[model samples]
Target: MASKLISGGLFAIAFLGCLVNAQLDTNQTAQNIHDPQPQTPATQSQNTQSKSHPDTQNRRSSCVVEQQNKIQCGAPGTSATVCNALNCCFDGTMCYYGKYVTLHCTKDAQMIVIVSKDATIPNLDLESVGLLSKTGNCSPVATTSAFAIYQFPVTECGTVMSEEDGVLTYENRMFSQYEVELGPRGAITRDSFFDLSIQCRYTGSTAEALLLEMNILPSPYPAVGFGILNVELRLANGQCHLKGCAEEDVAYSSYYRDSEYPITKELQDNVYVEVRMLGRTDPNLVLTLGHCWATSKSNPLSRPQWDLLINGCPYREDRYQTKLLNVGSKLMFPSHYRRFAFQMFTFVSTGAADPSKGNQVTQTADTVNPTYEKVYIHCNVAVCQPSTQYNCEPRCFRKRRDIGESKTFTSRQEDRTVSSQEIQFVALSQSV
Candidate 1:
């Protein structure tokens, strides 16, 4: 009876063990159905691509920000993404448009001649006995120092004109550009006039009917102030840091302001500027940026002013010079930009910043440090070829003087009577 009881207990233990093993197999199968296997890199990428929009597809391959996916622009106006419908850049009140092309600039005693000096116009002696006139296009060239007046955002270009258009526009002409070429928070300044003069000439028909006409006046007269820009380089806790000239950009350019990344070890000593021109080589005409001041009690037009640091020291030649330079300083140019109009590159190498001295920048002499290899500066000048689209038409715009009812006359108007017949005239009536 004892041996039969032991065999039955052993059978019960074996049956219970089989039931537990079967339950374990069922749990294992359920876990296998819910748990996922690790994915291969290719498989993970495929899944990620499936989630992205078609416009952003293959984004991993390119670094350029794809703009077409967002705002679509067509034509020149004040409301789209950019200002100046032609996509031309604005230099204070002036407009610069069209792709860059080469120009040759030259200065002289009579006039600043810029063009293909090699280019010539035909005299065209038609053998007809009469006053002759020849027309040939001339390029733009001159040295000037201007200021960066407006800081427009990529979003508020066209509509923000009244807020950003600090300079005046021409009554007869309007701009056609829209985008600012200064990059995200970039600014532009130019001085298109080094020396200026008003000219008058006679054009019309009939000996005594001719009249005089003057050239068109330049808009927003070549800035009467040197635009000030402060660039600083400093080392904080053994790390190299750089800064732009404008502290105000931070408030407007939050996108770039947050991108103030530290420089790598290799490029810590190098710096760059959008475009630069050494003010002068001889004695180095030193003038600070941000010039343009007004103190009118009735119509006050106050502007930023910078010190005219001549020869690394404050220029005492003009005591009033220290005060805000109300007028843009004359630009001292280099041999490369001596003649013809030529736009600068997108980025150019400039002097590096100092790492010491608390890295502080101010206008006072003690704070002024010009030891860098290149300074962030500009010329009070602009240039363009005839084929280019920029508004570089010589300030020589004029219309023929009007000649009224009396068509027959014997001598030039407002001049000594020239019955000598040495002065010939064509009988043509013009409306200016």
Candidate 2:
């Protein structure tokens, strides 16, 4: 009986042990399904690198900021995320200003007023304000969520200029200082308007600064004969005043403002030339342009030449296309300057196959070996004392004998020949 009881107890113990083993196996399987596999050393390194890769790429690429020149855009200790939300620049440690509403003067003698989109003026229409350009165009050049930029010439936009104590100030009074109602429309208060003022103080005289702004380099004339008979030849644009001196002929485009020699021009474009005498102050002395011609080479005597002016007049064939502008007669200039303009042309090849075609060459894609033409212009200038016998004025259609018969013009005294720098003519289809 004792043996049988012992055997039953052993069977029960075995059953319990089997049950515990099954429960352990089930728990292990569940853990394996829910948890990830353990990473190796290399796998862990690769995973870490992948997680950090996007942070480097997501950073702003052009966040260049100088430590000394940084303008604060946020309060101290501002978080990077918050600074970025403000559209301001952040340098990992601090936030700095980006773009804001401002007014400044440009080096080109112009006023630039930028109004940020964030700027607010109560009860005012920004576009319909009284601000305007020289031609009364008040439209902004560009508008974006960031800012609206308005440009105005210094002499325009209803700007008032005043000079005092060697300082020149240009002011745009958008709002009246004395009267609030006279301010720009929709202004609720005197401080609710926009205005701009810029002052230019020169270390030298104001005239020097003005000349520099105008890009007029006045060079002294070299003495030539008994009296100073120096002449200057300048190339100008169409905006140049017809009767003004070189100072008033400021180049509005950079193409004509280049001081480099051998100015380039397009074929058939009008080329304005100004010839002025310097150094002589005699009121009676008058300037006379005897002849003007162009040649392919630097030497005035080179072959393959063209005549523009002959015997104090435009060539007969190009009379309509060439014009001699009267200068120094108006109060704009002293009586020592003259101007002329002619259509730019290139000399056609004399060796063309057909003479009847008149040697007119046109640019085409099939043409081989395109070349630029170098042209040099020469002018014969004379400064003479006018008397009752000879006034030294140009007479276009008068007979040649009549000029030669004048006793005062017998000896060509104070005659100085001047030539312009080389000018290159490019084909109409080619880029300069």
Candidate with the greatest TM-score versus the true structure? 2
Residue-by-residue lDDT tens digits, candidate 1, 1-432: 000000000100000000000011112211111111111111100001011112322322211212221111112232322323222233333322211111100011011111110010011111110111111211111211110011111122221111223331111100111111121222111111000111111112100011111111100001122223211211111212345443222211211121232211110111111112233343222222111111111121211112222211222332223221111224333211211111211111111112243221111112221211111222222212222232222221122231111111211121110000010001111110
TM-score of each: 0.12, 0.40
State the lDDT of candidate 2 residue by residue for 248-301, as single tens digits.
344312224444333435434567777778776677667778878876677778
Candidate maximizing lDDT: 2
Off by over 4 Å in 1: 1-189, 192-373, 376-432
Give every collision pair in model 2.
Answer: none
**CA lDDT scores, all candidates in order:** 0.16, 0.42
lDDT of 2: 0.42
